[model samples]
Every structure is written in structure tokens, then in C-alpha cells.
Target chain A: MTTAEVSAPTTEKPKRDKPMGTETRVAWTFIAPGAALLLLFIVAPFVLAIWFSLTNQRLISPLPTRFVGFENYLGELADPLFWKSLWNNFRFAAFVVPAQTAFALLLAVFVNQRIAGRVIFRTIYFTPITVVMAAAATIWVLLFNVNGLVNGFFELITFGNFAPDWLNDPTWAMWAIIVVSIWQGVGFQMVILLAALQDVPGELYEAASIDGAGAWKQFTNITVPGIRNALIFVFTVTTILAMRLFDQPTLMPRSPGGPLDSTRTTMVHMVDLGFGRQAIGRGSAIAVIFFVIVLILTLIQRRFLKEESAQ
Target chain B: MTADSDVRVSAKKSVGANPLWRWVLYSVMIVLAAFFLFPLVYMVASSLIPDDQVLAKSQSFEAFVPTPFVGLENFSDAIERANLPRVFANSVIISGLIVSLGLVVNSLFGYALARLRFPGRKLLVGVVVALIIIPFEALAVPLLFMGAQVGWLDTYQIQILPFIASPLFIFLFYTFFLSIPRSLEEAAMIDGASPVEIFTRVVAPLAKPAYATVAILGFLFSWGQFLWPSIVTRGVDVRPLPVGIGVFATTPPVSWGDIMAYTVLMTLPLLVIFLIFQRQFVQGVASSGVKG
Candidate 1:
């Protein structure tokens, strides 16, 4: 698929300007269905979200809706639980972005080697990515049980000194979710980085070694720079994913964002308010805020990374 | 050393030529592999055991081994209790529609963007690129409100329609269509073939990899959909497997074995497909990741 296709000769050259009318009509006809759907689904919802945030809209309400400019936003800003959920989102991203990226890069480098059974190893590591997050969370909820295999292994290794109730414990709930997120997501980054690693010319490594460079030196100088763009890409994508932490926390915990609201991410909070509490206005407010944060982070990362790459 | 010797040294280093280092590398890979495989292996094993014995055996190495196997008892129980058949059919219909229709719609738009000289072509492409940055979660709340307002709640189309015109997939298709040579289309055009004929007979045949990549990824995305379906479908009539499994796992009188069985059942088809199309799966992910 990557190889360039050979161009074939034509029997006759069609006048491009003459077919402009027909070509434009055909193009619009082709694009119409998808463009209309995008307009109805994505664009319309986005606009409604902003409008809903401004007004006091309820999912099912008796009173007529009225404009309540900035009230929902102000309420959310004043709510400690809202701040907690936002903090939890940031905290999850902080741990996952670095940990998953590093681990994935490590796995990618290892599997990139010319080792026997590397394909099998790659497949094994990547199996989690295929499993649905709900299934992964369900399986992991059992594993993270007090007397489950995870604690059992930890007890065996630590001589029974430590075994926390992962999901129920407020302190450990987010951490458990983080572990699952990293486990399920690292394989994706690994595959991407592995592809990037393969693209790094072997000649550079050979040249570096000729200058008496060690493996670590060659890795730091040649390998890292070679895959710099991929590293940034992985970092940014992982952060965005971490910010959307919902399925695991919702499914794993006793309740969605249980244990003192410790695992209440922004998305979870939005859902709880919007659907569960039937506070559509507040939920839309949170959604707008969440969207802005994601947009700003993505834009900042793009600019920052582009500058770094330039340097 | 000579240039040839340097190449040999690097080649040897790439594979860990030293015996002890290679042994260490193998050991690490094996341990990591085991770590990655343990939860899945345990899930399968627990699914086969009886409910009472599932958690009991999880405390030790025996958890990895399915003893006192009850065969398909848990599977039968889970299917009956969770209404797995209905949910499974629902998931199949939903994902199938999304994948098939999505391919046609998104690929057509992509092809138009790549090949057609429409008036608003550049503007449409820019809009798609801009739309790619909007996370779906950010829109879920408002979409739910919109869905409720339009009386679209508790329907299969609500789950399937919004996702059919994905910006990311559209962009992926756009870039892929751009990459292929257009000479064949031109040749076909010279033969008095219309644009649609040229697209179907000449261009579509050559874009199999792009289609396969989009189809596999699209199916996986739709099949695993949780958030949208959760809010939209309040009943089991149209709920997909991911949401079904989530609800099943959380329902009262939770049985570990039954839940594992259900999970295994929910995951089995995708696992089989992934194993069969491992190359395409990896390629799909890598290409999407690198291109994005």
C-alpha cells in the first residue's frame, strides 16, 4: 500500500474546464450524505452544547427553559466536587502520559530487535487493545479484589506486608484505574512507536557505533531523535485519552465515581450530572469547559512540540 | 575497523549477539509476556470453573489453571440471565450498519475531496481537519440532550447514525485516496466511462487496503461503543455488547464465573478476528497513529 503506483496512459484527454459543471455536481452528490450527517450530528450538537450551557435546559422538565447566562459555569466553578473531578483528570493524565509512553517505548524497542518469537511477543502484549474497555474493566475488577490474584501476587512477593482494597479504597481507586489504563493502552503506543523505530535508519546506529558509541549512547543520540515526532505524538494522544477516563472508573468502582468521589473524572462528572441528575445545563457547561481544556492542551502541545522539533 | 566490520557489529548488537545479554533479553520478554497474558488467561480459566470456586481459586497459582471445570454451564447461565443473544444481535446489526454505510459515505466524501475540483473543496477539507480535534465525549452530553429532544432515545439508529460520518475516518480515507495514482481513472474516463463507473471499476478495486483498514477499525470502534449506547438505549432491546456486559457485570447477585463467561463471550469474536487479521490490525493502528 505504501509503494507508489505507476501512472497509466490515457487514450484521449478530456477537457477539464468543460466537465467542471458535471464534476462539481458529482462531487457534491458524493459528499452530500456524509456532510449532512456531520452537520446534524457533530456541528449541531456542538452548537447546542454552547447554547444549552447558556440556558437552563433540563432533559425532562415541567418549567419552560430560560436563559441563565453563566450561572451553570459559575456553579461548576464553585463546586468542590467539580474541582476534584478536574484534579482527578489531570492526575490520571500526569501518571499515564509518562508511564505508558515510557513503557510502550521500551516494549517497542525490545520487540523491534531481531529476536526469535518477537511476533508472538508483540501479539501477546497487544491482546489487551482488542478487548473492549468494559470487558477489561470487568475482568480487572475481579483481579483487583482484596483476595484476588493481584493482591495474592503482591502478598507473595512482599511477604504479606501490603494488600490494598483497590477499588473500594479512595486512595487506591484512581491508581487501580491508572494501572488498567496503562495496561490496556500501552500496546497501541507500542505498535506506533515500533513502526517509527523500524523507520529509523540502521545506518545511523552503525555509524554511531563506529565512533565507539555504546548502545545507550546510540539510543540517546540517534534512536531518540529519529523517533522524536512519534514520541510527541504518543505523548499528546495518551494525554487526551487519559483526560477521557470514564469506562474503567465507572465499571470498576462500586458506583460510578465512588469512594469519596476520588475517581470522578470530568467526563464521569458530566455524565452523572447531565443524565443521572438530569441537569442538562450544568452538564453542558462542564462539557464546554472540558472541551476547551482539551482544545487548549492539544493546541499548546502542537505548538510546543513543533517548536521543539524546529530546534 | 572496516565499514563492513562496523555493519556486522551493529547487526550483531541489534539482535544481542552476546549470549548472556540475549538470555537476559529473552527472560525479560518472557516475564513481560506472562504479565500481559495473565489477566486474560485467568479470565478464560475462571469462566470454565464453577461460580463458587472461581474467587476461591483466585488466591493462588491455581487461578491460572481451570480445575473442576463445569464446561458450558456458566456460559449457559450468562446467556440466559444477561439476554446475551439479543444484545449480541443488536451489536452485530449496529456495527455492521456503521461499518458498511460508513465506508460508502466517508470514502465518497474523501474521494471527492481528493479528486474533484468542487467550489468549496478546500473549505470542506479544512472543516474536516478542524473537526478531528473535537473529542466525542465533549459532545456526548449535548448530543444526549439533542437525542432526547428529537425523540431518538432508545433506538439503534441513535447509536449508529452519529458515528457514521467520523471526521478522523474521513481524513484517513482522504489521505489514502490521495496517495493512490489517478492515472487509471483518467484512462477509464477516456473510455467513455462515467465518473461513478470509473470509481467503482477502476479506483475502488485498487483501494482494498484502505477499505480493509477502515472497516476493521470502524467495526472495532462501533462494537466497543459504551458511552453513547449507555445514555441512548435504556433497554436491552438495542443495547450493544459492551454496555450489556457492563450492566451484566454490575447487576445484583454478581457471579464472577458468569461475568467472566459473558466477558469471554463478548470478547471471543473480536479476539478471533484480531488473531486472524493481526497484520491488518497492527497496520491499521500504526497508519492511523502515524498519520494523525
Candidate 2:
């Protein structure tokens, strides 16, 4: 039997009844602008990028470019800088993915309780999501300065002189960027998790309480299990964001990576190679590699989330 | 009977007694909330002070000082230095155009995916989802070349056109359309309504909330767009506020005070939008299963 025979008629329809005459033409007319824009901007650019990746084309040189086949890819594959930046991006993802998930989940549970001034707290927590990237980075640059607010606060608390310039020092630059990312990101994930928490049934919590479970036990066994779907969602999204880390380090007047190229993320490297240096072929190769990596990770995450939801 | 009553009374008493752990939990939550809010508060407070006293180390309570205040001096300076009035106008026009155009395209595509049976529907949806993961930087170089070739460079078409059919918005609207009851549209069809009529009269009215959700998200993304406009525009004439502020912030004299003021200026419109639509943004965020 064909697949169509087994499906309901509603699901098995294969054609649209063309609303005849001028209306049908008009409908297409309405869609023409969008269709044209998508073709010109999205589809055309994607195809062009693929073609450019296979040729040695520089943005500055207007001469006819020669097709190099896979040479660009080969060059990127052998470059040590590519490997180092790729490794750094993965490391950043590893730290951010787990830490952000745990922090967002914990904060969601804390705020889930029916406490006084709940709305106010929610607003306060989610305010950072609205902040522009430039502004946020500026504030962070000041705070992470040796004599700025964060270090000054640390000294006050410890009663010892301990101040390291966060964006300047190689040892701390990546971590510093990661910290800013988390501060910017935590609120968004928190809101998502909180929504998930609200959606979970309250009877399960009441039953756990009646069974003489402590707060910690209830949270670990009941709350965690209940919001597993949300936890997976947060992990996948944050992984994507962390892999695309660019603006903070890019805005710094120092090296794109800052302090011995410690903060050079893969995306930043690709941008510099393509736009700044005008090596389109090499940059396209990097983008393709980066795209492949993200694809594999997203597939893995989707599979994990699917399996968890199946339970 | 007396023994049963006493047992019930004891049960009620135990239920009424709040746990000590809950108190500590509330206190911890409050502290966490305060900690997260501190930076935003500090940013706003610092922007209110005169440029002379901004980083002075003399006044210990400088950020919190309400007296001897300079009102909107930083705002005026930031506006003057950054040419923010022009940037704000540009941002508003770009965001408005994108959102308006995006709504039309997404609605049509969403309806096609949801109700109309067409060839390659599943394939199209899959492509949209896959497009979500392709980072914007991947296409930046070719997109720039395309813009140059088409004479769209430094134009509104460059800023607004590419963003019109966001995969995220298409996915969002598609899901929303699927959830609407088919019977309503079916009835409309039976009553001699065309697909367009049914959509405009029935589905569109019912889908207001979803449209609002997409509109806000689209507007916010366009407003905060820096990387694309930064490369494409190349000057202050067509730059959005985020990139405009970014360029101005990097310019000489390095006034943290003016930067803060400009930051506040850029942030104020968004804050106002959020305040006015607080419930919608919150509800929209909750209903949409995706994170920013």
C-alpha cells in the first residue's frame, strides 16, 4: 500500500485549489516582494558564498578569480590558527553550556515560589536581556578594569589587594568574555525555565512534600525531572550562542582575542579573514567548517531532547 | 469523636506552620535578584551625574547621590556627539519597515504551510528550521558583495530586506497557525469565502497575539542589529543606533560619561517599549519555546 492510503484525507491532500482568476494572480502578487527579497538576499548569497569558497577571490582585487577547487579548505585544514580558535570555541561552549543551564534552572526554581514582590524580581532578573551589546560591553570593560567596580568590590570583601585586568590579561580574557556572556545570557534562559516551571503541575510537588521530602530532595527528584525538557532547550540554545561569541572581544581595542590572542573566537576569526583581510575563499572555508560543527551539535541536541521527551 | 477532632486539629496546625527553610529560600532569592539588578541600576545612576564627578573616587556614594544632580546633560552631549537623533530616526524606520514587511511574508508562508496543501511543504519547513542554525557571519561576505552588485549598499533595502523572512518568525507563525482550529476556516470556506478572505477575516483576527509576538521580536532584533549595518553602511548616515553608538563610543576623548549617556539614550526607547508592553513581551516569551 502507498503511504497516502494509510493517512487521513486531511493529511494526505496533495494540491491546493487554485483560487482562480485575478485573486490567485493577486495572491502571488502579494507574495512577490518577499519572494524576490528572499531570493536576492538569502538564496543568492548562500549560492555565491559556496562558489566563492571554491575560488581564490579577494574583495579588493577586481580581477577574474581562478577556481582553486578544494585548496582553500585544505589550507584551513592545515592552519594551526584555525585549530586553536576552533578548540577555544569548543572550550567556551563546554564551560558555558553546563554552567548556564545549571544557573538558569536554579534561579527558575528559586523564583518559582510564591514570594512577595515576585513580579519585581522577575523584571529585575530579565532586565539585562534588553541591554544593547555595545552598552553592555562598555559597562563590562569598566567593571573588569583593574581598578574598576568588580575588582574594587573583590578587594573590599577580601581586605587584600587583588586586582587583575580581566580583558587585558591573557590568562583571564576568555574567562572574562565568558563571564560577560553569562551575565547577558542568564536572564533569557531564566525566563524560559521559569515559564516551564510554571507549566509543570503543582500536585507532584505537594505529593512529594506529603512524603516527608526535604526542600533539596524535592527539588532534585521532582523539580529537576519535571523541567528536563526545558533544561535541554536551554542547553541547545546556549551552546549555539556560546559558539558564536564575537561582539565583546571584537569591540575591545586590543587584539580581537586580547592578550596573546587568547579570546579569538572562531566566528571572530572568520569575520576578520573574510571582511577585514578580504580573503573570501579562506574565510568561506572557515565558515563552512563552523557551519558543519554547529549542524552536528544541533542534531545531537535535537536527538537528546527528543529521547528525553519520549520518556 | 473527640480523639478524631484532636487529630484533625493537629494536622491543621502542622500545615499552618511555615518551614524555616522557606524563609532562608526567600532571603536568598531576594539577594540574587538584587545582585542581578545592580549593574543596570549602576549604569542608570552613573549616567545621571555630571561628567566632572563621574569617576572621581572622592564621593564614595557617588552612584546613589540624588542631590547636586545634573539632569540630561549627558543625554544632550550624547545626542550631540553621536548624532543620535538621526540614528534614532533611522532605527525606527528600519525596524518598522522590517516588521511590517516580515509580518506579511511570514503570514502568507505560514498559511501555506499550515492549511494549503502544496508540494515540498515539509521540505520548505525543514529548510527554514535548518536556516536557524546558520550563523549570520557565514553569509556576511557574499551578502556584502551582493549588496554592492545590486546597488543596495548603504540603503534601507540592505538593512530591511534580508531580515524580512526570518526563519525563526516563519517557524513561530507556522506553529501558531497549526494550533488554530481548522473548523473555523473550513466553515468560512463552506460559506463561499476564499482562502484569502478566510485568512484575513478569520485567521488573522484570531492570530493577533502571535502577530504581536513576532512584531516585538522582529523589532528588537532589528534595533540591536550591529554587525550587518556596521559593515554595510560604513558611515553614520544610515547606521542604526547600536552601531552608531558603537562607532561614537570608539571615537577619541573616550568619555565613559558620554558613552554611558548614549547607552542610556539608546536603551531608553527599548525600556519604554518594554514597560508599555510588559505583559505581552512576558507572555510572548513564555509561549514561544525558544530563547533569545
Task: Mark the regions of model 1 whose C-alpha exceeds 4 Å error after superposition.
Answer: A1-15, A308-311, B1-15, B246-253
lDDT of 1 by residue, A1-311 (tens): 11111111111114456687788899999999999999998999899999999999999999999999999999999999999999998999988899999999999989887778989999999989888989889889999999899899999999999899999999999998988888888999999999998877777877787798988898899989998888888998899888888898788899998888999999899999999999999999998998998898789778867787689
Give the RMSD in angstroms, all C-alphas superposed, for model 1. 4.6
Per-residue lDDT over B52-71 for candidate 2, one digit per residue giving the tens place of the 0 to 100 score: 55555312445545335778
Per-prediction TM-score, please? 0.95, 0.90
CA lDDT, candidate 1, residue B139: 87
lDDT of 1: 0.88
> How many steric overlaps are in each model, in order?
0, 0
Clash pairs detected, candidate 2? none
Q: Assess each prediction's global lDDT (C-alpha) against the native.
A: 0.88, 0.75
